[model samples]
Target: MAPKTTHPVLGARALNRATLDRQLLLRPASLGIPEAVEHLLGLQAQNTKPPYYALAARLEGFRPERLSALMESRAVARIVTMRSTVHTHTARDAVALRGLAQPGAIDRELALFVSRGGLDGVDLDRLAELARALVEERPRTPKELREELLPHWPAADPQSLSVAARCLLPLVQVTPRGLWERGGQVALTTTDRWFADSDGPAAGGPADLDETVLRYLGAFGPASVKDMQAWCGLTRLGPAFERLRPRLLAFQDERGTELFDLPDAPRPDEDTPAPPRLLPEFDNLLLSHADRTRVVPADLRGRTWSGNQAHRVFLLDGLLAGIWHLDEGKERTTLTLEPFARVTRADRAALTTEAERTLRLMTPAGVPHDIVFATR
Candidate 1:
């Protein structure tokens, strides 16, 4: 059978509008926090503040308190999922997707540590069990958890032992840690204990990978097999896409990579206007695709990535236009915007308006903020 192809091509701008619509960046969505999180597949939350900032940009009338409350209530959690990095997921996805990513994520992690002799003379199964018990007894920071496990595996590298448990077990970073505007250490508890009413990976194993692929496409698609792999850190998803190909709508980029998307998913017109959006650092929109030209321009791609660090970036006319940073002062907060290309006076005003809105979402009421446009 001939491989399916989408006729007439989706040009770069067309792909950009479609992607922005699906990501909720074209307009603020009406969905609540948990629903929005689920729809976006979860937000990259390596830091405490990005998820809050991300929600602010995507959801209408979003309040930091709403996300903070969800954290306090255990409705959402911070867990190491896709790409083996921390993400803020609704309690349900934290369990389901973490399980799907584990076989590969855990093996890679263990292999690296074992090569360093980090797990030498240590029985990993026993370490996992002990770590689970300690965390379940009460939420404990990685350092605290390490001290408790050291007695059991005295010769094992403390950092590696803790990391192995993280890889081997299903742990969730408990609250007060990810709560908005609150300071707390990175703490862990088993997903089983954190979401007592919910089922863990045992209830949804490899079978869940099928749903994972569909959900990824729903949120980030018209994407290639490599894009799916990049987003989830799972390899060999071509078969999963093949299995679902009969039901999916296929398209090809100008570069001719095969793309799959849900038939009913939104594909906005090429001219759909995308507002300037101030995205938090490591936002999934900037990281999810193999061919990021859909969102970030080809010539400007290297600007956002420095070594391993991805900077906070903003979109102007639906493509990455600049990078931004925030500095808080005792009396006022300043948001600095640095554009990679020339910005018109009109664009600067619009960018300032968006930056001010972001400041309001991030800081307390009556805390004044100033927007500074940096020299290119």
Candidate 2:
């Protein structure tokens, strides 16, 4: 057996600290915005706008337009990653993730739509070939892609076509829909055309979940295989860890749940001071865990969920301390903090200061509203 740490590797705080180190939230990050974006599997851009704001908080100097440019140039693409939701990831990741995620997404759609008789005996390979030819000339909206393919697969429900094509071809919704500050509608193209302008995905193939797993633990380490699965939405990560056994350092939590970490990964003392930070709504840290009690207090988790149920949030000492809203249409921003319990005057001041600065940055030319506090 490999020798374990003398102290038996303390509990979840140790794990949480390891996660903090990899994430750079324990301290300010030194990596470039693009690199940080890549490591986090493209910053979870479902709402389309918060990834920009999220990066600005974590990265030292981030600009929304740079991500926009990367999207336009196809260096990083917008595609589905974990949980089968849209993410803005690099070209390399987009391909691999699609390969792995497509099968699961297909199984889901087939159950949901197949009983409706949309794909009885339909040859998907033939459909993919035809769909590729149909869209190669230009990027088409989802509706357009459906119409073009409908004549051949008349039995296929037009509304279900987008989900079917998503599983068949590694498709990406092209910009200016994904561009920062752009209101452009979603336009469709295969990930190849969206990234490399070819109709085919690169031959190298599916993203190795083992390699992807190591990178995940590298960025969010001292984490369990369960946490690994939560972050990547892949089942059977045990094999990935098995392949990685030689390279990893292992421990057991208080519950004796086995956990893994990178050998040289950072593990700061629990007392190590953490700064106040505002996280974007749906930021992966909050999403990428099964037992959020390690980070969010159970009493407050419901409040955090309800507060950020819409748009954005603020973090004080790594917990979701409050929620912030940006009312762009009215050119005003308001921050509502629902403290689980009473907060110190000093911490409240700190949150206010951070909230004010972020609001100003997000709504630079707009009128400002006084920050609001509501306790539940």
Candidate 3:
């Protein structure tokens, strides 16, 4: 579809370049682990390794151990913030963003579980108090938390009690769970206890919704209200956009949907070179926006997932081009690429160089690595 003529429009490629620049994908950024986590809002961390791989993809001279150290020191943590999924966030954002999200996304998710009739006759306030006390004393795994809470409310669903605690409190996944190379099972604690020594926003204090909107533009802008909504899993944000309209720049997309961005935010040339990127499954670059055509091609929609699982994907020239799988052997590590379409020789070379760089940093040294492009 052609861009609408009524207003200055950003076509798909234009949007792609601008968003990639904001995402630190066009080039590796020179930023520390916590700073990068805050700037990108958070790293999708449904799995332990994605956050490390995500940092490797975006940061120059990134060592997995650096992030691991941060996790050990309470500098960053994994929590269920945006989209009600786990994200590795800076210490401060872990408090602020989770507080921001609690009223809407967290509560709504708990409601879904409540409506299932499992939480019948349960006093939500009592559940929150008991669960908070238990975790604050020490971090507890979801299973342990559920088992303890089940005895108190024998009639209530075991899982629902644990879910209620997560919703009612600003729970965070404690250390060793998110530490790279030293992984552990999921464990929960309130942000208040976890970041008690830290200085910044406190638990139960959410950042202003208006300020968050502006920050979202800075990171993933020229975006529609729906796009922002999709990223954070909050609704009725049109008012926040309206209040900031005077301070923002508005443009129409090809569909004539109004998009908002910071006036000074980078809107790179449409033809700017975008190197191939190997992103972890559920990377925010692919999941943040409602209209994903800017990053995902039309024909490749829904190709990233199978049933309920998401595959690790790679980009060629800034678009979703293929799936990648990694196999670790005692003697050698192999990375196989399965492209959605035939790749040109130049793109193939670039992909290999990128894969080797990732392997050197991620895999053990002296382990020979191979990058193979699978025949479709």
Which candidate has the highest lDDT of all?
3
Winner on lDDT between 1 and 2 is 1
Off by over 4 Å in 2: 1-9, 105-112, 197-203, 302-311, 329-332, 365-369
lDDT of 1: 0.86
lDDT of 3 by residue, 270-374 (tens): 999999999999999999999999999989999999999999999999999999999998888999999999999999999999999899889988999889999
> Between which residue pairs do clashes occur in model 3?
none
Sliding window of 10 residues with minimal summed lDDT for model 3: 196-205
- Candidate order by lDDT, decreasing, is 3, 1, 2
Pick the TM-score winner.
3
Which stretches in model 3 have alpha-carbon errors above 4 Å?
Answer: 1-5, 198-204
TM-score preference between candidates 1 and 3, better one: 3
Q: Which candidate do you rate higher for lDDT, 1 or 3? A: 3
The lowest-lDDT stretch of 10 consecutive residues in candidate 2 is 195-204
